[model samples]
Target: MVPKQTAEIFQILSKGNFISSNGSQARLHDCISHDDNFRILKEYFAHIGYHLESGHNYYYFSQQDETNTNMEKKLEQFAHFIDVMDFFSCLDVKPVTGTRYRVTQIAEECFANERLRQKIFALSRKDKLIDKVIEVAGSLANGGFFEQEDEDTYKVMDAIHYLETIISLITIDDDGEQKNS
Candidate 1:
Protein backbone atom coordinates (compact mmCIF):
# COMPACT_ATOMS: atom_id res chain seq x y z
CA MET A 1 0.00 0.00 0.00
CA VAL A 2 1.13 3.56 -0.68
CA PRO A 3 2.22 5.35 2.49
CA LYS A 4 0.84 8.52 3.96
CA GLN A 5 1.81 11.89 2.52
CA THR A 6 1.51 10.45 -0.94
CA ALA A 7 -0.18 13.58 -2.21
CA GLU A 8 2.30 15.84 -0.49
CA ILE A 9 5.23 13.95 -1.95
CA PHE A 10 3.69 14.18 -5.39
CA GLN A 11 3.20 17.91 -4.97
CA ILE A 12 6.83 18.46 -4.04
CA LEU A 13 8.28 16.33 -6.83
CA SER A 14 5.93 17.41 -9.60
CA LYS A 15 7.16 20.96 -9.47
CA GLY A 16 10.78 19.89 -10.05
CA ASN A 17 11.72 20.70 -6.44
CA PHE A 18 13.95 18.17 -4.74
CA ILE A 19 13.30 16.24 -1.58
CA SER A 20 16.82 15.87 -0.25
CA SER A 21 17.87 13.08 2.07
CA ASN A 22 19.65 15.54 4.29
CA GLY A 23 16.85 18.05 4.28
CA SER A 24 16.98 20.48 7.17
CA GLN A 25 13.79 19.16 8.66
CA ALA A 26 14.55 15.74 10.08
CA ARG A 27 11.07 14.46 9.37
CA LEU A 28 11.15 15.68 5.80
CA HIS A 29 14.50 14.01 5.28
CA ASP A 30 13.28 10.80 6.71
CA CYS A 31 10.04 10.83 4.79
CA ILE A 32 11.60 11.05 1.39
CA SER A 33 14.52 8.77 2.12
CA HIS A 34 12.46 5.97 3.59
CA ASP A 35 13.40 2.81 1.78
CA ASP A 36 9.96 1.31 1.39
CA ASN A 37 8.18 4.62 1.31
CA PHE A 38 10.33 5.91 -1.53
CA ARG A 39 9.79 2.78 -3.56
CA ILE A 40 6.05 2.89 -3.05
CA LEU A 41 5.91 6.57 -3.90
CA LYS A 42 8.11 6.04 -6.89
CA GLU A 43 5.63 3.59 -8.30
CA TYR A 44 2.73 5.90 -7.55
CA PHE A 45 4.41 8.89 -9.15
CA ALA A 46 4.81 7.05 -12.45
CA HIS A 47 1.10 7.35 -13.13
CA ILE A 48 1.14 11.15 -13.01
CA GLY A 49 3.37 11.68 -16.03
CA TYR A 50 6.53 12.12 -13.93
CA HIS A 51 9.24 9.66 -13.09
CA LEU A 52 10.55 9.64 -9.55
CA GLU A 53 14.28 10.19 -9.63
CA SER A 54 16.60 9.21 -6.81
CA GLY A 55 19.90 10.78 -5.87
CA HIS A 56 22.28 10.37 -2.97
CA ASN A 57 19.55 10.24 -0.36
CA TYR A 58 17.35 12.59 -2.31
CA TYR A 59 14.52 12.58 -4.82
CA TYR A 60 13.14 14.70 -7.65
CA PHE A 61 10.97 14.52 -10.77
CA SER A 62 11.76 14.01 -14.42
CA GLN A 63 9.86 14.14 -17.73
CA GLN A 64 10.87 12.79 -21.08
CA ASP A 65 11.21 15.15 -24.03
CA GLU A 66 13.00 14.76 -27.34
CA THR A 67 12.92 18.32 -28.57
CA ASN A 68 16.16 20.27 -28.74
CA THR A 69 14.65 23.63 -27.81
CA ASN A 70 13.67 22.55 -24.33
CA MET A 71 16.83 20.50 -23.97
CA GLU A 72 19.04 23.44 -24.99
CA LYS A 73 17.36 25.75 -22.54
CA LYS A 74 17.85 23.24 -19.78
CA LEU A 75 21.51 22.82 -20.67
CA GLU A 76 22.14 26.56 -20.76
CA GLN A 77 20.59 26.92 -17.37
CA PHE A 78 22.41 23.90 -15.98
CA ALA A 79 25.82 25.07 -17.20
CA HIS A 80 25.65 28.29 -15.22
CA PHE A 81 24.17 26.45 -12.28
CA ILE A 82 26.90 23.79 -12.43
CA ASP A 83 29.67 26.38 -12.17
CA VAL A 84 28.05 27.84 -9.08
CA MET A 85 27.60 24.36 -7.60
CA ASP A 86 31.30 23.71 -8.21
CA PHE A 87 32.22 26.80 -6.22
CA PHE A 88 30.31 25.60 -3.17
CA SER A 89 31.45 22.00 -3.63
CA CYS A 90 35.01 23.35 -3.36
CA LEU A 91 34.49 24.57 0.21
CA ASP A 92 36.40 22.75 2.92
CA VAL A 93 33.24 21.98 4.84
CA LYS A 94 32.28 19.43 2.22
CA PRO A 95 28.71 20.53 2.61
CA VAL A 96 26.24 17.79 1.79
CA THR A 97 23.14 18.83 -0.08
CA GLY A 98 21.34 19.54 3.16
CA THR A 99 24.26 20.69 5.27
CA ARG A 100 24.50 24.10 6.84
CA TYR A 101 27.44 26.48 6.39
CA ARG A 102 28.38 29.81 7.86
CA VAL A 103 29.80 32.82 6.08
CA THR A 104 32.27 33.46 8.88
CA GLN A 105 33.86 30.06 8.36
CA ILE A 106 34.43 30.70 4.68
CA ALA A 107 35.71 34.19 5.37
CA GLU A 108 38.10 32.82 7.95
CA GLU A 109 39.44 30.40 5.40
CA CYS A 110 39.85 33.21 2.90
CA PHE A 111 41.96 35.09 5.38
CA ALA A 112 44.21 32.10 6.01
CA ASN A 113 44.63 30.57 2.56
CA GLU A 114 46.41 32.70 0.00
CA ARG A 115 45.03 30.58 -2.83
CA LEU A 116 41.47 30.95 -1.67
CA ARG A 117 42.05 34.63 -1.07
CA GLN A 118 43.48 35.04 -4.53
CA LYS A 119 40.60 33.20 -6.04
CA ILE A 120 38.25 35.45 -4.12
CA PHE A 121 40.20 38.48 -5.22
CA ALA A 122 40.26 37.38 -8.83
CA LEU A 123 36.50 37.29 -9.01
CA SER A 124 35.97 40.60 -10.75
CA ARG A 125 32.28 39.81 -10.70
CA LYS A 126 32.26 39.88 -6.93
CA ASP A 127 33.96 42.11 -4.36
CA LYS A 128 34.00 40.35 -0.98
CA LEU A 129 34.74 36.72 -0.31
CA ILE A 130 31.49 36.10 1.52
CA ASP A 131 29.50 37.88 -1.12
CA LYS A 132 31.28 36.02 -3.86
CA VAL A 133 30.50 32.75 -2.20
CA ILE A 134 26.95 33.82 -1.50
CA GLU A 135 26.55 35.00 -5.06
CA VAL A 136 27.62 31.62 -6.29
CA ALA A 137 25.41 29.78 -3.86
CA GLY A 138 22.49 32.07 -4.52
CA SER A 139 22.85 31.54 -8.23
CA LEU A 140 22.75 27.81 -7.74
CA ALA A 141 19.81 28.17 -5.43
CA ASN A 142 17.96 30.30 -7.91
CA GLY A 143 18.55 27.73 -10.57
CA GLY A 144 17.32 25.04 -8.20
CA PHE A 145 20.80 23.59 -8.03
CA PHE A 146 20.89 23.95 -4.26
CA GLU A 147 18.53 25.10 -1.57
CA GLN A 148 19.27 28.02 0.73
CA GLU A 149 19.32 26.96 4.34
CA ASP A 150 19.59 30.41 5.79
CA GLU A 151 21.36 33.71 5.21
CA ASP A 152 24.72 31.95 5.22
CA THR A 153 24.31 28.22 4.87
CA TYR A 154 23.13 26.42 1.74
CA LYS A 155 21.95 22.86 1.48
CA VAL A 156 22.92 20.77 -1.46
CA MET A 157 19.82 19.57 -3.31
CA ASP A 158 18.88 16.66 -5.56
CA ALA A 159 19.23 18.48 -8.84
CA ILE A 160 21.02 15.65 -10.54
CA HIS A 161 18.46 15.85 -13.31
CA TYR A 162 20.21 18.99 -14.46
CA LEU A 163 23.52 17.20 -14.47
CA GLU A 164 22.09 14.27 -16.39
CA THR A 165 20.57 16.62 -18.89
CA ILE A 166 23.87 18.39 -19.49
CA ILE A 167 25.85 15.20 -19.67
CA SER A 168 23.55 13.72 -22.29
CA LEU A 169 24.12 16.73 -24.53
CA ILE A 170 27.91 16.66 -24.22
CA THR A 171 30.28 14.43 -26.16
CA ILE A 172 33.79 13.34 -25.16
CA ASP A 173 36.69 12.66 -27.50
CA ASP A 174 39.31 9.91 -27.20
CA ASP A 175 41.80 12.51 -25.90
CA GLY A 176 39.26 13.54 -23.23
CA GLU A 177 38.08 16.72 -24.88
CA GLN A 178 34.47 17.58 -24.07
CA LYS A 179 32.27 19.35 -26.59
CA ASN A 180 28.60 20.11 -26.86
CA SER A 181 26.90 17.79 -29.31
Candidate 2:
Protein backbone atom coordinates (compact mmCIF):
# COMPACT_ATOMS: atom_id res chain seq x y z
CA MET A 1 0.00 0.00 0.00
CA VAL A 2 1.20 3.51 -0.77
CA PRO A 3 1.70 5.93 2.09
CA LYS A 4 -0.59 8.91 2.53
CA GLN A 5 2.19 11.16 1.31
CA THR A 6 2.36 9.10 -1.87
CA ALA A 7 -1.31 9.78 -2.46
CA GLU A 8 -0.69 13.46 -1.91
CA ILE A 9 2.11 13.28 -4.46
CA PHE A 10 -0.25 11.72 -6.97
CA GLN A 11 -2.74 14.51 -6.43
CA ILE A 12 -0.13 17.16 -7.25
CA LEU A 13 1.16 15.36 -10.34
CA SER A 14 -2.37 14.71 -11.57
CA LYS A 15 -2.53 18.37 -12.46
CA GLY A 16 -0.49 19.43 -15.50
CA ASN A 17 1.96 21.14 -13.13
CA PHE A 18 5.32 19.61 -12.21
CA ILE A 19 7.29 18.62 -9.13
CA SER A 20 10.89 19.80 -9.32
CA SER A 21 13.84 18.69 -7.26
CA ASN A 22 15.28 22.16 -6.75
CA GLY A 23 11.95 23.91 -6.54
CA SER A 24 10.42 25.66 -3.55
CA GLN A 25 8.82 22.37 -2.53
CA ALA A 26 12.12 20.50 -2.26
CA ARG A 27 10.87 18.40 0.63
CA LEU A 28 7.99 17.08 -1.44
CA HIS A 29 10.32 16.34 -4.33
CA ASP A 30 12.69 14.47 -2.04
CA CYS A 31 9.82 12.58 -0.51
CA ILE A 32 8.70 11.44 -3.97
CA SER A 33 12.26 10.40 -4.92
CA HIS A 34 12.97 8.40 -1.76
CA ASP A 35 14.03 4.75 -2.07
CA ASP A 36 11.47 2.56 -3.83
CA ASN A 37 8.76 5.16 -3.27
CA PHE A 38 8.43 6.12 -6.95
CA ARG A 39 8.03 2.51 -7.98
CA ILE A 40 5.40 1.83 -5.35
CA LEU A 41 3.54 5.02 -6.19
CA LYS A 42 3.64 4.22 -9.90
CA GLU A 43 2.02 0.85 -9.39
CA TYR A 44 -0.61 2.19 -7.02
CA PHE A 45 -1.53 5.10 -9.27
CA ALA A 46 -1.89 2.83 -12.30
CA HIS A 47 -4.69 0.89 -10.61
CA ILE A 48 -6.41 4.16 -9.82
CA GLY A 49 -6.18 5.33 -13.50
CA TYR A 50 -3.16 7.66 -13.64
CA HIS A 51 0.09 6.99 -15.48
CA LEU A 52 2.96 8.32 -13.45
CA GLU A 53 5.61 9.93 -15.60
CA SER A 54 8.93 11.53 -14.82
CA GLY A 55 11.24 13.89 -16.63
CA HIS A 56 14.63 15.38 -15.81
CA ASN A 57 14.24 16.20 -12.10
CA TYR A 58 10.47 16.58 -12.41
CA TYR A 59 7.27 14.52 -12.46
CA TYR A 60 3.94 15.17 -14.21
CA PHE A 61 0.86 13.32 -15.37
CA SER A 62 -0.12 12.44 -18.93
CA GLN A 63 -2.96 10.37 -20.27
CA GLN A 64 -3.45 8.41 -23.49
CA ASP A 65 -6.45 10.32 -24.84
CA GLU A 66 -8.10 13.60 -24.06
CA THR A 67 -11.55 14.81 -24.95
CA ASN A 68 -12.01 17.12 -27.93
CA THR A 69 -12.59 20.14 -25.74
CA ASN A 70 -9.56 19.29 -23.65
CA MET A 71 -7.41 18.90 -26.74
CA GLU A 72 -8.67 22.17 -28.16
CA LYS A 73 -7.93 24.00 -24.96
CA LYS A 74 -4.45 22.51 -24.80
CA LEU A 75 -3.72 23.42 -28.40
CA GLU A 76 -4.88 26.97 -27.83
CA GLN A 77 -2.79 27.18 -24.70
CA PHE A 78 0.20 25.90 -26.63
CA ALA A 79 -0.34 28.53 -29.27
CA HIS A 80 -0.18 31.20 -26.60
CA PHE A 81 2.92 29.61 -25.14
CA ILE A 82 4.57 29.55 -28.55
CA ASP A 83 3.98 33.27 -28.88
CA VAL A 84 5.37 33.91 -25.41
CA MET A 85 8.38 31.77 -26.26
CA ASP A 86 8.95 33.66 -29.48
CA PHE A 87 8.87 36.94 -27.62
CA PHE A 88 11.41 35.68 -25.09
CA SER A 89 13.60 34.24 -27.83
CA CYS A 90 13.65 37.66 -29.46
CA LEU A 91 15.19 38.96 -26.26
CA ASP A 92 18.95 38.50 -25.85
CA VAL A 93 18.09 36.33 -22.86
CA LYS A 94 17.38 32.71 -23.72
CA PRO A 95 14.90 30.79 -21.66
CA VAL A 96 17.15 27.78 -21.11
CA THR A 97 16.55 25.78 -17.95
CA GLY A 98 18.24 27.06 -14.78
CA THR A 99 18.67 30.57 -16.14
CA ARG A 100 17.85 33.31 -13.67
CA TYR A 101 16.21 36.53 -14.88
CA ARG A 102 14.98 39.65 -13.18
CA VAL A 103 11.85 41.59 -14.11
CA THR A 104 13.72 44.87 -14.12
CA GLN A 105 16.39 43.52 -16.45
CA ILE A 106 13.88 42.31 -19.00
CA ALA A 107 11.90 45.52 -18.73
CA GLU A 108 15.03 47.53 -19.34
CA GLU A 109 15.82 45.49 -22.40
CA CYS A 110 12.30 45.98 -23.68
CA PHE A 111 12.50 49.72 -23.11
CA ALA A 112 15.63 49.81 -25.20
CA ASN A 113 14.08 47.94 -28.13
CA GLU A 114 10.86 49.04 -29.82
CA ARG A 115 10.27 45.57 -31.27
CA LEU A 116 10.69 44.00 -27.87
CA ARG A 117 8.30 46.52 -26.37
CA GLN A 118 5.76 45.72 -29.05
CA LYS A 119 6.06 42.02 -28.35
CA ILE A 120 5.61 42.61 -24.66
CA PHE A 121 2.57 44.73 -25.33
CA ALA A 122 1.02 41.95 -27.36
CA LEU A 123 1.60 39.34 -24.66
CA SER A 124 0.71 41.52 -21.70
CA ARG A 125 -2.50 43.24 -20.72
CA LYS A 126 -0.63 45.55 -18.37
CA ASP A 127 0.24 49.08 -19.43
CA LYS A 128 3.54 49.79 -17.69
CA LEU A 129 6.74 48.20 -19.00
CA ILE A 130 7.63 46.68 -15.63
CA ASP A 131 4.12 45.40 -15.16
CA LYS A 132 4.25 43.81 -18.60
CA VAL A 133 7.46 42.06 -17.72
CA ILE A 134 5.94 40.90 -14.46
CA GLU A 135 2.85 39.61 -16.26
CA VAL A 136 4.76 37.53 -18.74
CA ALA A 137 7.16 36.20 -16.15
CA GLY A 138 4.30 35.47 -13.80
CA SER A 139 2.53 33.49 -16.51
CA LEU A 140 5.62 31.34 -17.07
CA ALA A 141 5.99 30.84 -13.34
CA ASN A 142 2.37 29.77 -12.97
CA GLY A 143 2.91 27.30 -15.80
CA GLY A 144 5.68 25.55 -13.79
CA PHE A 145 8.42 26.55 -16.20
CA PHE A 146 9.85 29.19 -13.85
CA GLU A 147 10.22 29.52 -10.09
CA GLN A 148 10.08 32.84 -8.32
CA GLU A 149 13.26 33.11 -6.31
CA ASP A 150 12.39 36.51 -4.87
CA GLU A 151 9.95 39.38 -5.38
CA ASP A 152 11.30 40.28 -8.83
CA THR A 153 13.62 37.40 -9.72
CA TYR A 154 12.77 34.05 -11.32
CA LYS A 155 14.76 30.94 -12.12
CA VAL A 156 13.78 28.72 -14.96
CA MET A 157 12.78 25.21 -13.90
CA ASP A 158 13.82 21.91 -15.45
CA ALA A 159 10.23 21.38 -16.51
CA ILE A 160 10.86 24.09 -19.13
CA HIS A 161 12.50 21.36 -21.19
CA TYR A 162 9.05 19.87 -21.62
CA LEU A 163 7.84 23.00 -23.41
CA GLU A 164 11.05 23.24 -25.42
CA THR A 165 10.73 19.62 -26.49
CA ILE A 166 7.17 20.14 -27.68
CA ILE A 167 8.15 23.29 -29.55
CA SER A 168 11.04 21.47 -31.23
CA LEU A 169 8.63 18.81 -32.45
CA ILE A 170 6.68 21.43 -34.37
CA THR A 171 7.87 21.34 -37.99
CA ILE A 172 7.29 23.32 -41.15
CA ASP A 173 7.12 21.29 -44.31
CA ASP A 174 8.73 21.97 -47.65
CA ASP A 175 7.24 24.48 -50.14
CA GLY A 176 6.46 26.96 -47.34
CA GLU A 177 3.88 24.75 -45.70
CA GLN A 178 3.21 23.76 -42.10
CA LYS A 179 2.14 20.32 -40.93
CA ASN A 180 -1.27 19.84 -39.36
CA SER A 181 -1.45 17.46 -36.41
Question: Quick one: best TM-score, which candidate?
Answer: 2
Tens-digit per-residue lDDT, 1-181, candidate 2: 5666875676667766788877776677777778877888778788877777777788777778669999899999999898888888888979887789899999999999999989999998887999988888888888888899999899888788888889888875677566543
Worst 10 residues of 1 by lDDT: 20-29
RMSD in Å for model 2: 3.3
Question: Relative to the true structure, how large is the alpha-carbon lDDT of every model?
Answer: 0.65, 0.83
What clash count does candidate 2 reach? 0
lDDT for each residue of candidate 1 in 6-91, tens digit (9 for 90 to 100) = 77777676667776654543465587566787777777778776888776556678887569898898777766655544445566
lDDT of 2: 0.83
After superposition, the stretches of candidate 2 with alpha carbons farther than 4 Å from their true spots are 1-4, 176-181
Clashing pairs in 2: none
